[model samples]
Target: MMAPFSHTATGKKAAMALRSQLAQGAKFLLGLWMAGVIVAMFVIIPQYEGLGDAGRIIIMHVPTAWVTSLAFVVSGVFSALYLFRRRVSDDASAVAAAEVGFLFCILATATGAIFAQIVWGVFWNWDPRETSILVLLLIYAAYFALRSAIDDDNRKRRLGAVYNLFAAVTMPFLLFVAPRLADSSLHPNCAFIQGSQCDGITLELSGARIGLLGDSKLELKSLERQGDLVVADVNVTRPGYQVENHRPSFDLASGKPADRPEFDGEQFMLAVEQVDLATGTARLNIEAPGSGLLGNSRTLLTFFASMIGFTALFVWLYRLRAQLLMGEEWLAQRERTYGFPS
Candidate 1:
């Protein structure tokens, strides 16, 4: 006959094992859904060419926005569950969703900024959409900061739950509802599904249109319609190396010293022009200070800053939830060894 304590232990272990399985299953499904979302964004949607006409912005922007909204919704629900049930699993789920939400928010902001640069002639102008999204990001950022400031688990969980609920309530108003009623702006109010009556635009892409067949002139017109400008009649010259006023040939094509032709740096130049009407002229002066022309190092700084910020966030989350994640793993091991439930 089995002892009563042993029976109770077995039941508890079984319950925990079920919960772990449920969580893993949920995570797996979410991952698969996200993968399908990526395919839709990159492959299925872009085939229309109208979406591609926006230049990858639509894919990045719309999906990130969807993920951001869904993630916060998940976070809020889990927060409420944690508050009521006081379960560490609920808290972990909420925090995980929040982190993913934050990532999507940042991506949405970046893609929006890039689109603004192409369409609005600036990266950020504090338009209704831009300002609201910025505020939303800041609010969630404060949620994380507040969590870090609190040392006690109970306090952190309670405070985070309250903040999450508040943020979730305001999100719809800030992101969707308010944008439509507020003002006339260049930003597209795409969140409202029913009231958006703008005609859907389409772009036709074919082999013949882009000079894969028939005529080069037809291809130029198609390229112009697609917001592309072709460069023609380009003249390039490489500067010559001088030794005591004697000039030596430095081939620009080969990027090396060649004896075929003697070229002088002062007399060498390239005059380039584009044949497309939809494009603007660009002149690159390599000697200009703080110039963003051609190649510049500013983008590298932006990459490193984002990397460090997210790395710090990851370290903070891992340390905060170490015991919970590790404990869940240990419980699973014990269950597998003993059977019945774990």
Candidate 2:
């Protein structure tokens, strides 16, 4: 009986040692993988057409933002689980995820500011997307503050779990829905993606068809095909600005806008989407800076790779933090029960 017990203990120790070795290997590989992703973000990706080298920040910025949302989702789920099962481990996990999420959120905001300064010539203009992210950071900050304020561990966990769930419920609206709902947002999705704020308006040259794009009135004056390119004469009128005849051009062969003329005294550009010379019709759009950046295959791939790396990093961080918290809780419980020094 003693020999069998000894063998069983030895086998368990061996298994534990193996798992530790495997975890260390995985962590080392993740570090190397993230290093490669950082290198690729700058060296492998091509310069964006409108944004140039400044577009590289999107590889980091978008991923951090995505990981922020994912972390919050994990926190909310664990918070709900703790409420249902009354498990201290679940509470620890929830706290760990929220802390990680908050860190990622700050990174996302910082990178976004850098991108904004390069593209929009300002660090922050309080755009809808920017404002929403700021709000999210504050909500999570309050979550941590609430946890620190409570003296009783049980009450803190219960109250924090409830607050975390509420905060998580608001995450989707603040990050995705609210920003898209704002028509005045200069976000990339508003300009490039279909069914957003700047979907481009169709106008006929002879029918006096005029449409409003943002605060500007646009009317197609003429459409002409010049060799391999199609050009459109658009009459643009802003409320406090002079009426200007903006000639935006498109490439017939490439099926893309060739010349995107900047709006007068503004960073926004006028993009000609389609021009039908035979029917005297044209589609005009207002493109914000950094619009259509992900259209490039290289940029898209690097961006996705960065996202995956950041998400994996978040998972590692969450696990480590949860274990640390659980350990502290165990030590505290032992001290309270048997007067053991914590």
- Number of the predicted model whose lDDT against the real structure is largest: 2
Model 2 Cα lDDT, one tens digit per residue, 79-109: 9999999999999999999999999999999
Off by over 4 Å in 2: 1-19, 190-195, 206-208, 214-216, 238-242
How many backbone collisions does model 2 have? 0
Clash pairs (backbone) in predicted model 2? none
TM-score of each: 0.49, 0.90
Model 2, TM vs. native: 0.90
Model 2 residue 127 distance off true place after TM-score fit, in angstroms: 1.1
- Please write out the lDDT profile of model 1 over residues 163-200, one tens digit for every residue: 99898888888777666564334465532242231221
Worst 10 residues of 2 by lDDT: 189-198
Total backbone collisions for each predicted model: 1, 0
